[model samples]
Target chain A: MSIKQEELEEIYAFAVQLGKDAGAILLERAQERFDGSKQAEQGHIEKVNAVDLVTQTDEDVEAFIKSKITKQYPSHKFIGEETYSRGVSRDYLIDDEPTWCIDPLDGTVNYMHLFPMFCVSIGFIVNGKPVIGVIHAPFLNQLFSSCSGKGAWLNESQKMPLTRNPTPPLPPNAPSGCVFSCEWGKDRRDQPDSNLHRKVESFFNMASEIGGREGKGGMVHGVRSLGSATLDLAYVAMGAFDIWWEGGCWEWDVAAGIAILKEAGGLITTANPPADPATAAIEEVKLGSRLYLAIRPAGPSANETGRQSQERTVREVWRRVRHLDYSRPGV
Target chain B: MSIKQEELEEIYAFAVQLGKDAGAILLERAQERFDGSKQAEQGHIEKVNAVDLVTQTDEDVEAFIKSKITKQYPSHKFIGEETYSRGVSRDYLIDDEPTWCIDPLDGTVNYMHLFPMFCVSIGFIVNGKPVIGVIHAPFLNQLFSSCSGKGAWLNESQKMPLTRNPTPPLPPNAPSGCVFSCEWGKDRRDQPDSNLHRKVESFFNMASEIGGREGKGGMVHGVRSLGSATLDLAYVAMGAFDIWWEGGCWEWDVAAGIAILKEAGGLITTANPPADPATAAIEEVKLGSRLYLAIRPAGPSANETGRQSQERTVREVWRRVRHLDYSRPGV
Candidate 1:
C-alpha cells in the first residue's frame, strides 16, 4: 500500500537523524586514528594484514543502526553491509516487506586510510522500490536526504544541484562537457580480458582526445575516482558529477543514492545497454544486478523532454564503453 | 642573502592573505556558474569548444594578483600561470632574485565543472628554492600554508597532518597501508610508449594483488584521482595521502605544494629513481623538472630514522613504476 505524505515525511526525518548519529560515531572513531595515536599505529598494521580495525568499526556501526531501526520498527526487514558479508542469502533483497537497506560505513577502505570520503547510508524500500534515502558524510559536513514525493535536499537547507534554480540541461554534445566518475574497484586482476582491464581501457577512451584513439575517444571533460560509490552518487545527485557508471558493488552501496538521484530528477539504468537499444525503453535495473549507470537531471531542452536527454546520454556512453560482466555471488 | 625569521614571517603572512583574496575572487566568479545562472548557460557552450569563459577568469585572476603583488613588492619577479603559458623562457625559473610563483586559478577544469577542487596557489622562491607557500581552496574551506623554517599548517590553526602529536611511522611494508594519489592528466594519448600509458600501467601495478600480475603489483591500499595536483600535494602534507607520483605538470602547478610538503617533514624526489637505487641519495628534483614523487612525513621507527623510511619508500615505489617522459614545450 502507498504511504501517505505525512508518514513519508516522518520516516524521512527519522532516517536523516539516524544517518547523522551514525556519522558522528564514525567521525569520533576515525579522529583517533587520523591523529596518529598509539592505538592507530597498532591498527595500521592490522589494516594492512586483515583490516581488523575497519571491520570492527563497520560491525559496530551496523549493529548500532540495526538496533535503533528494529527498536522503532519491529516488522521491518533489514539488509546491512556487515551482516550480508557474513553470508546472508541474496533472496532477502527481493522481499516485498518494508526493508531497510543500510551501509553503515560505505567507504571502509577510505575510512581505514583516513581519506575522508566515507559515510553512513540508509535507504527505505517499499515493494522493492526505494522511497526514502539519507546519507551523511561527517567529514564533509554534508547530509543528503530525499523521499518519494518530496524533493531531494543537502544539509536540509541547500537543495540538490545547489543551483537554487533548475538544473542546467546536459551539454549539447553529451559527455563532451561532462565530468564523469568511476572506480577502480577491489578486483584488480590484470588479465587482458579482466574487468580491471576493461575499466582501464574505458577510462582511457573517455579521457582521450576527441576523434583520437581510432573511434574509441570520448574526450569527456574529466574523469574522477573518489573511492566511495555512495559519495560519487551523492555528488551526482547534486549535479556536480554529470555521469557515473560502475560494477561489482553491492545493493546497499547505491540504494540510498538511487533514491536521492531519482528525486533530483536524474535517471539510473544498467551499465550495459538493452538488446534492442534502438527502440527499447531504457528501464532501471534490478537493485541486485551489481551494475549501474546514473546521469544527472536534465533541465528543459528545445528538441526533447528531460527523459529523452538522459536516455540519449546513456546510449552515447554505452557506445563508447566496453561491456562489463559482474555476476552476483549466487546468481 | 638568507632571510631573517622576522622577514620570512612577514612574507608568509602576506602570501596567505593574498591567497585568500585571490580565492575569494575565484569563488565569486565560480558561484555564478555553479548556480546555473543565465550567464552560466551561455558560458556552457563556450566551455565545450573554446573554453573562453575559464580562460577569461584565469586571466583576470592572474592580472588581479600580479597587480597587487607588484604594488606591495616593486622588485619581486613574478612567474604566473597565465603569463608563462603565453610564451616565457624557462630561464627565468632559475633566477637568483626573490620570485613569486603563482597559479591564480589551479584546476581550471574542476572549476569549470563546479567540482569544488579548484584553488589559488602562491609560492615564494629565493635562490632557486621555494621558501614559503600558501594555497586557499574557498569551496573546501581549507587554507594550507608553510615556510622553510616554520612547520606547515591547515587553516592557520591545525598543524599539517592534523595530528596533534608526531606523525606515525610508515607501514613496515611501505605501500601496503598507503593511500596513493595520481591523475590522468590532459595528455591522454593511448600509444603504448606514451606517458599516459605508462602512468596507467603503473597505477594498475600498484593496485593489483601482491603476488598477482607478473610480480608487477605493489598492492597499494587505495588509489585516488582528485583532478587537482595542488590539492593532492596539500593532502599529502596532511598525511591523509601517503604517496603521490606525477609528471607532465608545470612548475607553477606544484611550486607552492613543494614548499608545504617539505615543511611538513615530507620528502620530494624525482618520480624516476636514481640510476643506482641502492647506493644513490634520493635528492630533491628541480622545480623545472616537471616530474615529482612526494611522500608524507615519517615519525620515528624502531630501526630507521624518519628520513630513512621516506627514502626506502621512494625506492620501493620506483621499483614498481615505469619511467615517464615530459619535455618542455620548446625544449
Candidate 2:
C-alpha cells in the first residue's frame, strides 16, 4: 500500500488539476446565481432542513470529479460527499484499497451565498491515509496541494505557512496566544445540554477572560469561524490559524485537508480530550471520526519539540471544551 | 459645503491609492512576521488587553497615511485608530467640515495572525456622511472602493458583488434565507447580562430552528465570522452576506465600509430593532452609534421596493437579537 513518493506526486498533480477544474464549475454556477440568471437554482437548491444544504453544483462537480478520476485511474475506488450522501456502501469509507476522497464543494452554503469561502477538495488515500491532497478555492484564487514527503504548497510555487521559512514556534502560553477556530455546525438544538448548547458554551469559555469565569476560561487570543471546515483546516496548515477544534464534520470535510496539514508539519488528533490526558503519544483521529482537532506547524521550542507543542495545545483546549459526540450513521 | 460628484471621485481615487500603499506596508510587516524575520515586531506589539491588540505597524501606517493625506489636502481633518486611541479631541467625531477616517490596519488581530482577513480602510466624510471609501486587502489581492454618487467596486474592474449586473432581490422569508455576519468582539466578560453573553445567546436564538425555544429562533441560513468588521462590511457591500448585525465596534472600524455599502445600494441602520416594529420608515444609524445593521442591495419584489426588503430584513433580525449598548468615549 506504500506508494513511491514520485508516484504520489503524480497523483498530487492530477488532483490539483481535478480540483481546479471542479472549482471552475463552482465559480460558473455561483456566477450564474449572482448574475440573477439562475432562476432554476431556487428549484435546484434542496434543503436537508433550513441549516444543511445541497445544490445542483455540488452534485455536478462531484460527478465531474468522479468521472475524471475514474477515467484516469480506473482501478481506484472513490468516496465523494454527494455520492456518500445518497447511501453509498460504508465499505468504501477507507481500506487497503487506493481510494479518492472528494468534497466537490466543501463550503456549499458559502458557495450558495457567493461568500468566497467555498472550494473543491480532492484527496488520494491508500492504506486508510491521505497521501496526496489538493484544494482549490476559485474565488480566492488559492490552490493548496501536498504529497507525502513532498512539502505542501500554495498555488504551485509558494511553500505553505506562506512564510517561505520554517514555521515559528508556538507562542508562549501556547493556546493563550493562539488564534483559535471552531464552527457552529448545522445542529442548532437549544436544549440545556445539547451538543449545540455545549459548543456555544465552549466558545464562551474559550473566549472569556482568564480569571473572570471560575477558572474555566482558556482566554485564547481570538475566535474565528469562516463557515467552512475545510478552509479552516487549510488555514491551520498555512499557519494562519494556530488550532482548529471541530465536531460534526465528515470524512470528506477533513480528508484532503489532513493531507495538506500533515505534509506542512501540522498535526491532527481527536477532537475530544484523550482518556489519558497525560499520555505522551499522539493519537491521530480516524478518517470518519466526525470530530477532529488540528494544530498548526510550530518550530521546536526551547524545552519542547514541535510535536510536544501541538500536543500541549490539543490538551489545553481539551481542558476548556466539553466532549462533543457526532456519531456516524449506523456506527 | 456641497462637493461635486467629480470631486468625490477624485477623493475616492486618492483614498484608493492611499489604501493600497498602506496595505503594502501592512503586507511587508506581516511578511516579516510570517517569515520569522520580524524580531523587532515582538518588541513592537503592544496589547490593550488579552484580546485587544496594537502593533508598531499600526502606528507607523497611521503616521505614514496621515502625512500623505495632510500633504495632499491640508484643510481636510483626519481621524485614525492609532492616533485617536492615544487620545484625540472629540470635535473631529463628525463635524460640518470634511474629515478623513482611517483604520490603517482594520483587522490588527487578523494581521498579527497572518489570517488574511485584515485590511487598510480609508473613509472620507463630509457633513457626517461617508462620501469616499476604499479598503485594500493585500494578501487577498482585493481592493474595494466607492465614491458618494458613483458605484462601489472590487479591484476597480469587477463591480461590487462580482456579478457584473445589478444585485438580485433578497430571497423571500428574508433573514430566514440570509447569510448572516456577526463578530465576537474583544469584550468577553461572562456575566449573565453581559453584552458578550447576550451576543452569544442572540446567535443561538438566530441559528436555532424556526419553532425552537418558544419562537426565539430566526433560523438564519448561515452564520459566519471572518474576525474583521471591515471585511464583513465590504462583503455585505459586495452582496456576499445578506445582513450584518454588529455591536461594540468604533467609527473607525465602519466609517469607510458605510460609504461602500451605501454606494452599492445597501442599507445601514441601528443594530437595535426599531422602536415600533410596524413602522415603514427606515432609520439610518449615526457614525458613532456603535451598534449597526447592514443589509445588501436587493432588486424590487412583488410589492416591496429594495428599500422595503432591507427594512423588513432588519426588523426581522431585530426581533430575534437582544438590544446591545456600546457607548462612545465620554458620550
- Identify the candidate with maximal DockQ: 2
What tens digits encode model 2's per-residue C-alpha lDDT throughout B150-248? 788988976776543445677678778788899888877777788888888788888877777678777787888888899999999988899898998
Residues forming the 10-long window of minimal summed lDDT in candidate 2 chain A:
A38-47
Clashing pairs in 1: none
> Candidate 2: fnat, from 0 to 1?
0.57
* Segments in model 1 whose C-alpha atoms lie over 4 Å from true places: A38-53, A88-94, A164-166, A275-280, A329-331, B38-53, B88-94, B163-166, B329-331
Pairs in clash, predicted candidate 2 = none
**What is the overall TM-score of model 1 with all chains considered together?**
0.93
Instruction: Return the TM-score for each candidate structure.
Output: 0.93, 0.96
Q: Give the fraction of native contacts in model 1.
A: 0.51
DockQ, every prediction: 0.52, 0.58
The best candidate by TM-score is 2
First chain TM-score, candidate 1: 0.93
Candidate 2: what lDDT? 0.83
lDDT of each: 0.82, 0.83
